[model samples]
Target: METRPRGRDGTGVTNTDAGPGLVEPVPGYRTRVVDEGARDGPAVVLLHGTPLDLRAWDPLVPALRATRRVVRFDARGHGVAEDVPVPDVGRLAADVVAVLDHLGVADAHVVGHSWGGEIAQRVAVEHPGRVARLSLVCTRASPFPPFGELAASLRGGTVDLEALLGRWFTPAERAEPAGAAATVRAWLRDADRERWAEALDMIATFDGLADLAAVAAPADVVVAELDAVATPAHMAEIARTLPDAACHVLPGARHLAPLQHADAIARVLLA
Candidate 1:
């Protein structure tokens, strides 16, 4: 991977690639897919959350590429994915399988963060054979309360973007490395407003707990100790519900634990 400061401008092209490699498995939405690592290595797919693109995985991608073929993509309504009608969890899950099929990948290790984590759960449950292992980071199995509130607040026109991010991440975390907060802030700002809102609306009403029993992959549920959206208790419940799931709580992290604690998350994904 090229070293270009690790931030994408919503074009679906990262530092390593010169052009967007888009695939349209289904009409209307063109998904941006990227592949890295060895030509003949175990495949691993990384999924990003709402309001951000695949660049959210920049911190963990290099480490994962060391031993696995790391794939990252921009989900519909985010990054380079065309602005189409918001898709339900089922369609989102289908998109993942389509991306894998487009790459001719029979199976892969799946990793997701926040909203992406919920989609990852759907992929493991809905397409059990396609996922070798699952890693859910800072996600919940049931509907997320914070998203509902955020949608309502945004609709009411009473929230500021920066303030909203502050609520998602702690003040201390935003202060870390001086410019850590800028990357995420810019990502959210560049997203298509209509699509971003619709995606959040869909996520606010989603629930994946009903399908937990069908997930056959060995799973790791990682949560941040300071996460307010997907609380530690909620993640614990998710872990307990999964027949083959283990939970890891990283200290001093927030909702963006996958990026904030990338090393810890990489360890979990690599394990």
Candidate 2:
């Protein structure tokens, strides 16, 4: 395993030397498993969203590791797994399944943020046997009204990545923006523009409203009170769809609530 500076968390990121355990070829991508805590503990899978990588969960992983085996990996177009094409929601969920199968994990508590949440929901719907529980943070049940426009705009030209980051973090977070910027830069460095555009296209065209009612897993829907990306109403709607889901709104947080309120999210997920 190799180690590298992953910002202020003190814990150096662990690179899986031989790639995560998997039977079939993942086509263009590789997987890395960051094994933490007891090997026999409950498995918890963490998935990050667009413009960010696995490191986005750095602050929360340690907290979660105290009681469970926290597994975090970069999405196909996002981190170390940079070779896979940007995929639709179903394919994204399949990627999660592939990771679990590779690691010999039968079932796990799945936690996802933003677009990652969409993938998580699909996993619960399509591959229900593999997901033990679900946690959706700053995510929506279906494609938002403005997603098409946003995807078009992103495809048109270069995006002001800094401005996008500014909108996600609170004023206090913006005070020390280096940490967040570095995370975003790492994702950008790993992702191709065409792949990112394709991912956005998939997101814009996705429709999951009809399938949400079939989800039977226990779920927790977390929303940031000040989130501009996925509004609180969207989070509430997601909670409403699941038969056994509950909602929690984090005060004084923006779209990046999972990062700002990592402890709280970890506590809820572990509980």
C-alpha lDDT values of all predictions: 0.80, 0.73
lDDT of 1 by residue, 1-271 (tens): 2212233665425533434566787777776677878648899999898878777887888887877888888888787674666678889989999888878899999998988998999999889999999999998788765677777766676657878678666677666655557677766666666677776776677787868877879999998998887889999988988889999989888888766789999998888
Error of model 1, residue 19, in angstroms: 7.1
Q: TM-score, each model?
A: 0.89, 0.86
Q: Provide the global lDDT of candidate 2 against the true structure.
A: 0.73
Q: Alpha carbon lDDT of residue 92, candidate 2?
A: 80
**Predicted candidate 2 versus true structure: per-residue lDDT over 202-270, tens digit per residue:** 667667866878988899988889987678887787788788998988887788777678888877887
Off by over 4 Å in 1: 1-12, 15-20, 172-178
- Which residue runs does candidate 2 get wrong by more than 4 Å? 1-13, 16-25, 170-172, 175-177, 185-191
Best by lDDT: 1
